[model samples]
Target: MATLLHIDSSVFPGEASSTRSVADAFRATWEERHPQGTVIYRDLAAHPVPHITADAWSAGYAAAAERTPAQSAAFALRVELMEELERADAVLIGAPMYNFSIPSTLKAWLDNVLLLGRTAGETPSVEGTPTVVVASRGGSYTPGTPREGYEFVQNYLEAVLGGTMGLDVDFIVPELTMAGRNPALSALVPLYEASRERAFGEAVGRAKELAERFAA
Candidate 1:
């Protein structure tokens, strides 16, 4: 059976977080289709991974026989994260926008897993793996929007996950997430609701589509 690596980096739990909610729909649909398949889940908000350190950074460049004890210990966790990424046939990420960027916890996980000679570089191990990112944001940032130039979440991730790691990446954006909470954006609630509905549909559809592409 195929393995799905699902990561939720939103601070809010369950339905409170737009990204998490959309990702949950995707995972539920995937599980329903692949009853016997495996899922490796990580809740980065609840249990944040250690940020990259000097020891961890240095160890990746050192040969097996040259690494010190500290480097070995630091590199162990990085190896574990990378192994999970490598073993997965498909990946699902809940990358909610925060300050026009990704959560720091998600960044930490990316730092640990992005080894130069391993997950990164030409002909990477998981180069062709399918990845779906749920990019939920507080406001609309479409191409024609006033603040479209401020969009960094999708652009940054496209470079890292698609360009650097070589994964085949797709995004399901649920925009205007703050419409219900922000008084100033009350008029845009209708658009936000529509976007949310669209995101859920995309998530479920993408899961089923990917399920058909691989054998158990």
Candidate 2:
């Protein structure tokens, strides 16, 4: 059976978080399409990966036989994380915007998994794997908007996952998620609902399509 790595970095759960909702729809559809497929899930908000430390960084570049005990343990996790990425036929990331970028937890996971000589070094281990990122933001940042250049989630992810790792990455973003929650964004509630609907719809469709395509 094919393997899928599903990672969610949202601090909030259920209906409160747009990223979670869209990810849930995608996962559900993907499972329906490939019931026997293997799913390796990591909820970063609950069980966040460790940030790369000086020791870990040093260990990552060292020959495996030369790593010290502490470095060995730290580097071991990195190996496991990279192995998951390598084994998966597809990857799904639920990343909510935090301060105009991805959550720290998600960033930490990326740091652990994107190891040199494993994930992208030597040759890209996950090259050509389909990676779907559900990038949810509280406000809109489309072109010409005041926050246009401030949006960094998708761009940064594309640079790392697509540009660097050579993954076939696609993004599904649900913007203006705070419209009904925050008083300042209350006026955009209708637009927020429309955007949410469209995002979820596309997410579900994309999930099924990818699952079907990869099942072959």
Number of the top lDDT candidate:
1
Model 1 per-residue lDDT tens digits across residues 1-216: 989999999999988999999999999999998999999999999999999999999999999899999999999999999999999999999999999999999999999998877899987888989999999999988999999998999999999999999999999999999999999999999999999999999999999999988763
Could you tell me every candidate's TM-score relative to the true structure? 0.99, 0.97
lDDT of each: 0.95, 0.90
Off by over 4 Å in 2: none
Q: Candidate 2: which pairs clash?
A: none
Candidate 1 overall lDDT versus native: 0.95
